[model samples]
Target: MNWCTRCVLPDTRPGIVLDAAGVCSACRAHGTRDEAVDWAARAAAFGELVERTRALDRRWDCVIPVSGGKDSTWQVVTCLEHGLHPLAVTWRTPGRTPLGQQNLDNLISLGVDHVDFTCSPLVERRFLLASLDRFGTTAIPMHLALFNVPLTVAARYDVPLVVWGENSAAEYVGDTAATHRLDAEWVRRYGAVHGTTAADWVSDELTERDLAPYFGPTDAELEAKGIEAVFLGEYLRWDPEMTARVAAEHGFRARDEGPRTGVYAHADIDDDFISIHHHLKWPKFGFTRSFDNLSLEIRNGRLTRDEAIARLRELGDETPYDDIAKFSAYVGIGTDDFFARAERWRNPDVWTRRDDGVWTIEGFLVDDWPWS
Candidate 1:
């Protein structure tokens, strides 16, 4: 229930630690990035990498994993601006919106080879439901595919570099000094699949072959093949608003409906089901996507802690009802069953049921939270 003095994020968020000053690790990491990071030096290093990859004279100098999000578009624009020919790759979410597809097409029209890697819909459905039933989240399959697809493409195509957008560990988990390589170890730590790999998810229903797209080349294989998967965030500064602006300048469109899951119209908008993954955090960690987005804004000096709190109060009852219905239908489950399974994973430490049969977080940041 401990909230960061600098931002609205709580200590309950996994991998977030509050130091003695009551500042969360993520905010402290952002401070370190601002004060200690030598962005000019990092940019020079990236320039060298770009030159080296270009000199390889391959068909594609890099593989950029993308979801048509602002960050991914920014990644593509940055790579193209650096004169690196990157093959854009998408994992093809089952819940992709029309806007998502349009943005993806626009990114491809930015002039690069693209691959829309689609796993079997049957397998995806089974995996989605299994992930929901077992891990209490529907994002495991999506995360697995997004992480694995581009790397697999890179290894198979002999692309020397895989350009990932950002290091979630550094930005979200306070691991500011994380290795630039997005290898198996990094996946195990920050892949958001509960530290489980594709092999671990094999079940009676989902065979190894059915989950082939989820398995990427191992670190050893990547090393042997001289395939280096790196985070572009390590080389260049990454701010959410800045990235969104860059994307908007490059023909990326924001949602007309606004703020699908968080404070940004541009984020987490690629997949309809992804919001459910973030919404479930309210029950499990006592925070919503608004907390995450607002924390970043506070860290970036766009909002005060009090202002972020007010925004959270305004964004009450962030229960992705339509998304839940669509996802439930896709996974052949009822809406009642969906919530019932989500309820099973509610963190007892963060939530308490009231006498009136409503769940509430006792030490929540918002004093008058509209708990539904």
Candidate 2:
């Protein structure tokens, strides 16, 4: 597979462009939009949002869901500086990486009060396993960590307004999903299912027959409670790299301890893995490492077209088999047949059909987990 000549993303991605010089359309599109955004104006707009939200109640003025990633850190700092007494909320997931832990600590050190929301370790483990079993991903906790608990906590505290760092599709990923993206919908669907993810993993333990009292959403909740969720990045000029630099200046250090090729996520933050998982799942989707390396090259500015191709050829056939096993064990499945089932989910075209008739994936799908 070739990286889009325009932005360094892969050409296989539908709607992405590939030019002769090996740039992708995402890059070109971003270039166009970047020129139009008045970042200071957007920040002014954010201040207005803060003011309007604060005027809504005497309850905790605002709630900022934070994982201490650069964007979250920036949001919290902005909230605190605005003199809004914000409640920092986080969902502690299993395998919270070392850097993630530090980011959380830093948030505490910054003197904002926070609620540490966590699940039983066993429950977290089981969920990871279940995520692997059901969705082929063990990092499902990271995906769910940002949602659910916040609203549940909001109801308890009666905190009506919540600020989030950014919306993936609208702000950073691209604008295809932007026109109709609604903030209220983001609030409702954070924990259930997303536009891009499956719903069964988190709710699997609850039997449909028994979940009558807990159906996903109740319209009455939104109509009366004034529960408002806002996306900070959409109306603002935002760049992850720029945010990272700002975060570093504010004492947010890189979790220098994790993987280089794959993002070693901060202990509990959600940003890195969401990007990395795409790479893990890409091979399963028939795209190769071309898509993975290209993004980095775009970010770092070293990704030549030829270099991307060579790297894909060199890296395409790897998988995370050990991660799959650990994820399997965490969820309590020990059968060899399960791995076989997982193997079947691999990128159907690139995964191997072994001599024994069972399928084999790039060893990286869940392979070579140093933690295990």
Candidate 3:
């Protein structure tokens, strides 16, 4: 539960490394981007990639997996602004909020041809509940489909390129070696599913064929089709607030108020269950969305470390019980069962209960930075 010297991230976060100086790997990674990366050169390389993909005999130059959130909208606009035709693809989350649906439709209003893929609700519910029951997070299936389905569509449409958003390794987690890779193996290991494959989720009721959409193509198939997937964030600087502003100009809307659990008004707005998913991180990882959002702001130089720490203290662990109740109803589980399952998933290495019955993490509440 040691905190990063430079950001609000805890050492308990997976793939995070705190150096002897106490700076976390994510802060170190951002330092590399700021100090060494030549954005002009990267942009040039991206232009070449766009040209090569556009020359392929396909209806679209690339497939951009979108959530109709600010980042996806920004990705679509970025492709269009660079003269690349992108086919936007969305794997619809089961708990689609009204605003989520409207924002998703906004992508179409931007004049791009869009495809929405939905799973059978019965199967999706079963998978979601199973994920909650086993992994303590309901986002496993959604994460799997988010990364897999777009590539499947790319192969089906004969599109040679798939454009993804940020590289989590570069922005959030992983060692320096992973900062620049977007290969299937890298994604399979560190992407949202966090090494949990669809094979791990197969059950008596769910067959291989039923889970095909969640399974990405084999490496040979992807290579044979000449599919090249790249991260747009690597080429262009990624600032969530900036992207939200840009997307707002293009008909995207943010939540009227900030979400119950996080600082961002626009992020994760497409799914009502996202807040619950983020809230669960507190018990499991000792930190949650506030740490993530504030870290980004810290990296972007928008907030001082003190301000970020204050914000995290004020808002980080506030659980959105309403969102949790919604998710429980969606998965046909009781609210008590939901909390019981959440408690089961808490990492004892990171969390302890006080006499007052409040959960807390050790070595995380810093009175000041630059700890000696």
Q: What lDDT score belongs to each candidate, Candidate 1 first?
A: 0.91, 0.56, 0.82
On residues 224-298, what C-alpha lDDT tens digit does candidate 3 reach at each position?
999988889888888788889989999999989776457888888888888888888878987788788888899
Q: Give the per-residue lDDT of model 1 (tens digit) for 22-117.
A: 998898889878678889999999999999889999989999999898999999999999999989999999999999999999999999899999
TM-score of each: 0.98, 0.72, 0.94
lDDT of 2 by residue, 1-372 (tens): 554544435455544555577666566556566576677887787788778877876568767788777888877776778778788888765445566778778876786789877666555655555555566554455555456566556656777777777665543244435532234355344332333232344365734332221222233574467766666676555556666776777788775544333432222243333333444454455453345435545545656556655555545444545544554454566647555655555666455666777545444322332211
Higher-lDDT candidate of 1 and 3: 1
2 against 3, candidate with superior TM-score: 3
Clash count list over all predictions: 0, 27, 0
Q: Which of 1 and 3 is the better model by TM-score?
A: 1
**Best-fitting candidate, measured by TM-score?**
1
| C-alpha-based local distance difference test score of model 2 | 0.56
**lDDT, ranked from best to worst:** 1, 3, 2
Question: CA shift at 122, candidate 2, in angstroms?
Answer: 4.4
Model 2 residue runs over 4 Å out of place are 1-3, 11-25, 121-126, 139-142, 176-205, 208-220, 257-279, 286-329, 333-339, 349-372
CA error at residue 283 for candidate 3, angstroms? 1.0
